[model samples]
Target: MFDLDLWREIFQSINKNKTRALLSGFTVAFAIMLFTILFGIANGLENTFEKFFIRTAENAITVRFGTTSKPYKGLKIGRQVRPSNKDLDYLEKEFGEDIQYMSPKISRNYQVSYKKQKGGYTVTGVAPDYQYIEKAEIKNGRFLSLKDVNNKEKICVIGRLVEEDLYLKESAVGKYIDLEGVQYKVVGVYSDGGGDSQERVIYLPYTTIQRLYLGKDDIGDISLTYNPNLTVDQALALVEEMTIKLKNRFDVAPNDQRGVRIGNQVLTAKKRLDNISSGLGALIPIIGFGTLIAGILGISNIMIFIVKERTKEIGIRKALGASPKSIVSIILLESILITTITGYLGLLIGVGILESIGSSLERYFITDPSVSSSLLFSATIVLIIAGTIAGFVPAKKASKIKPIIALRNG
Candidate 1:
């Protein structure tokens, strides 16, 4: 039941003790404000981690060759260990079930000209599966096809920035672009999540690059995506197994780390995410305890003091036939009203600050730093409940004191 008279009494009491009420409210508001901002920053850090990893396919792995550091099978140290088209075929044949997509990469820097515009760009030759391995989105036309590689067709797929740089407003698809003296037809225009650097290059058939530049079936590197159904452990194991086999095939020592460098995106992302989660787990409790506990304790102490200060008033009300329940209700209601209003004010200020500084914090790897609506709602409820309990103990004690004793103490 809504009691107007009781509410009036609460307001009158609060008006008489404005400084005490304000102090109590400030303690809770500060606590809630600190809580909201810390959580927002944590969420921002997590967003940054996710965005960084999501640029490439999670199951993707790359194998690059380097000079052998150890000798094996009479092959001296410092011999270059080069991966070739044969290596790509061997992996497909050996781990066909575990592999989803595979590609051989051959990269070179070339001066490209379209009409009158000329620019220096990296031309990477790759198989059709490179599209999925690189997570490229074809905005128009199609990516490299199997026919292009099989026939050694002089065709290329240009990135979004490539189109913008040389072609201007014109689309690059189906147009012939001069790479040095050789002209290659652009078959597709694609975009990448890895920013402008990734989108500034051109893609061609790996076979064409091998034939034109190397005059042999050599490749720069091998990229492949493991089966999506494989667990993180399984994917990592497959990479390790593949590395060992490749090292053995090249007559490199088993412990030669530099000879065969295999990088697993899945493993890297997992480790990073695990580290982030562990950090957040440790940070939350410290923030909660430091802020919330202090607020709770502050409010609790203040409520007890308020009851002690009003001992004479409580005694007078009791003498005037006021019930114990009525006395408790006034104090509890006053506490709840103050906590609810101040808590919400603190929440609003915290969220506003996050939204305002969100863009600037991107340089620090902090993305959208704000709390969810549901969490805000929960915090408000918690503050109200905390306020009620803080008030109840002191209110109950004050109600129990005899009128004569309260009068004497006052």
Candidate 2:
């Protein structure tokens, strides 16, 4: 595989017209580099979408109570329909098998203070399943357990921003913080990757908030995830059916969408993902193929010029009993060497740039830019094919050169 003499001959040919070779190689390299970076950007865009929707499960559906806009079954219009724990119990009884995960959220705004560090923070009461819904990360201690919910523990999970505001450099876990006038022991410090705004919240057991803040039967909102295996159409159908059932239970008209606000994050995310997938599917090939064709054309043009310039040399070799096949192989080897080297360099530089940028792009919603191995492999195949064709056409033309004509022309 290591042909020293062949390489020397190729190098000699390249050095004879270094400017032209360099220019042709630059074209191929630039094309590959652009392709690599564009592909990485596409991947980054997809990652950003994944992170944007990470606050809930991909197939999660959230329901919030709203006022009845249309009167139904003798109920007056403009009546508020409030969902409570009784509704959760009813849903569990009616559709337990279909529900994957469920949680209730009740929020209150209170001034939290600890040793003169006082600020208004939104206190949220949630079930244990709420952790999954939030994708909450525990930096210290532990998240609330089901035992804490059942026992109505006065323990809370503070966010990173809360911890910073209340405790400063000290750890928040095991410390007591005053929520309004009530004292709650911090059991954990959590972060949801939602920035400072989301960090300005605390999580407590829903039952605790229900019993003390609101009535024991009160619930502000419900979050549930259905079967993940369901198709987008099926999932939306389920959401519609559940909305109707909820409206009917509260005596709101079925046609009144405002009576029950349904947040089908699954459907929303699925539709967005579908659009992204389709968009990338149509976009990447066009750009990649177009650049590749240009690169191939550049290589073909350069090879043709090289063939014309070397006509006398090719004629001399043929006059000395060299076969057309050897001339073809020589030309092909030179083309492949130029294309492969340039393309490899371009790929290396492109990937190096992406890797160096690292997670800094995440702030702009572009996280972990990367190219797939299959894409690189495909590009390599394209290079090989293009190199062969670029060489083949010129090599064929060079082989047909008559010694008498070539010598006379030279």
Candidate 3:
């Protein structure tokens, strides 16, 4: 129902008490604005964390060798612990079901040249499965094959930036690149999510690298992805068991941490998720309390004051035969209108601020900071409902006032 006369009365009251209306509106607006911005920043922090972790395979585990920190059996402390191809085979044979993809890496920096365009870049020798473990996308041809590894062929896969640097917009596939005076044909070009540093590199068959560089089967590290179906706890348990077995195999002390270091992505991701969940859990209540205080205390106090100030006018209206419903309607509608409009205004302002400054906050680990549309809508509805309830209490009292008593009190 359209009620022009009722709305006119409500508008007149608001216009007359502009300061009071503005003050009441300000409290709700400020609370909602703070709520929106805080949530936006929290979401951005989550985005940053996700981006950091997505650079590598989610199930990846890396084993790196270091000098033994403690003596075991007849071996002395400070003995260098090196892994070899035999260890890779042993892992496959022992826990083949738990493994998904495995690769042995032997990395060295070499002066690479393609027709006079020369650059110093990392050259890594890896098995065919290294592509999946590294999450490398084949842009041109194909990655290292099983035949390449078996034959010890001098074929290589170059990163996207490596191709760009040396080939100058031309494809690196089917071309020969000189690596420290040894010519290796480019079999493929790859792109990685890990950014430019990961892209400025080259990959070759592990056997070829062993024969050409070390003249042995020694590898620098082992990288593998565990079965994706394994739970986090199961993955962790697998790593622990594998660690103990490797230590025993090498005759190192059971508790020697440096002899064989295993890095598990599952453990790292769990810790990160726990931290983020805890932070968000703590934050949500504080923001809720702030908005609650604005609604229950701020709006209630102001509505009470407005009713007290208008006692005489309420009495006059009652004396002039105005109904109790009309009095209640005027005050309640005024509260709802102010709260709804101001809450939405605050939401818009908060979103605008995030849009303008989100890019600059990257250093602070906040990315794409903004609130969801549904969340903004929900906040506004809550404010409106709060305002309606707050107004109802005072409006009910005002309606029950005796005209004579109200006049005398005024």
Candidate 4:
């Protein structure tokens, strides 16, 4: 029930010992503020790490062949193993359902030109799906399509750097650029935000490069992004199976590490993500609970002092027939009020600080340092509960005070 008289008496008690109450309130405020800041920082760090994985598919695996380390079938060691379009076809035919996106790429530096403007840039032969694998953001026009690859169309996607150098202020799309004296119509301009080096490349259909430029079916590397539903363990197992199959197909030893190397970013990304999760999970509770204990202790100690100071008053009330429940409720309500007010203020301040600086930290990849609304609500509830528990002992002692003994002590 609402009681104005009780509230007035509580305010009077606070005014009487302002410094003690202030100090107790400060403890609660500091603890909550510290917890909020730490939670923001932890989330920021996690966000920063996540950006590294965004450049490529989170569950991608790149396959590259190297020289054999072990001799097989009386063949000498150090035989170089390389993948071809036939191997790509075999894999696709065998495991079509397991693949999300797959690309067989071959890259070479060529003299690229538009009129008199000429620069040596890496031209990569890629399938339509390679655009998705690279996460290339199309600034203008469209990426390579299946029709372009199937018909071996002389179409290419130029990077932002290429567009700037060759086309200048003009649109590169629908313009023809010469790559090694062969004209390819520019279909798209793309960017990866990976800096100038990444932007100095051009992409063309793999078939066109195979038939016209390279005059071979050999691929430098094969990259594949698997189904999103597959776990890291499942992806790794698929990679192992692919490695064994490829090794057998190419006459490489089964246990030769150098023969077929599958670089699975899925495993790496998963491990890093797990580390971040474990770190934040363990750290937040320790710091938050430690601060909680400190605040509770501070409030408990001050409540004991308040009880001792009110001994004579409590004795007078008891002699006037005041109930023990009412005495306990008074102390508990005071504790809860102090904690709730201070804790809410602390949360507000902490969130404000994070929002103010969040944008500035984007260069460091720490974007949106924040806590959930549910978390804040939960903290408020915890504060009130802790306050109630802290006040209970002091309130019980005050209620037990005998009129004669309390008056004598006072």
Cα-lDDT of candidate 1: 0.88
Whichever of 1 and 4 has more TM-score, that candidate is 1
Which 10-residue window in model 3 sums to the lowest lDDT?
287-296
> Candidate 3 — what's its lDDT?
0.88
In model 4, the runs with Cα more than 4 Å from the true position are: 1-12, 67-71, 74-80, 193-195, 265-269, 272-276, 297-301, 314-333, 348-370, 388-410
Score each candidate by Cα lDDT: 0.88, 0.84, 0.88, 0.84
Q: Residue 325, candidate 2: how far off, in angstroms? A: 5.9
Tell me how far the alpha carbon of residue 376 in candidate 3 is from the true structure, in angstroms, after superposition.
2.5
Each prediction's TM-score versus the true structure: 0.84, 0.85, 0.81, 0.81
Candidate 4 Cα deviation (angstroms), residue 297: 5.0
Clashing residue pairs for model 3: none
Question: Roughly what TM-score does model 1 have, to 2 decimal places?
Answer: 0.84
Off by over 4 Å in 1: 1-6, 51-55, 67-70, 76-80, 96-100, 145-154, 181-183, 211-216, 226-237, 255-258, 264-273, 352-368, 400-406
Q: Give the TM-score comparing model 3 with the true structure, all chains together.
A: 0.81
lDDT string for model 2 (1-410, tens) is: 88788789889988997987798788778878888888887788788778767766777888888888888898888898788878999989877877888988898899999998999999999888888777788989889899999999999999998999889999989999998889999999988775677778899999999888886668888988888777778788888888888887888787887778788765877887778777986897788778888878877887788788888899898889878988888889888888888888888888988898857888867788899978976896697678789879988887888887877765
Clashing pairs in 2: none
Writing each residue's lDDT as its tens digit, candidate 3 over 1-410 gives 99998888888988998998899898888877877887888888878776766667878899888899999998999999888889998999988999999999899999999997999999999999999988999999999999999999999999999999999979989999999989999999999998999999899999999999898899888989889898778889989999989988888798898989789755767667757767776876577657656665788888888888888988998999989998888889999988988888888888888899999999998878878899888877877888898899988998899999888887
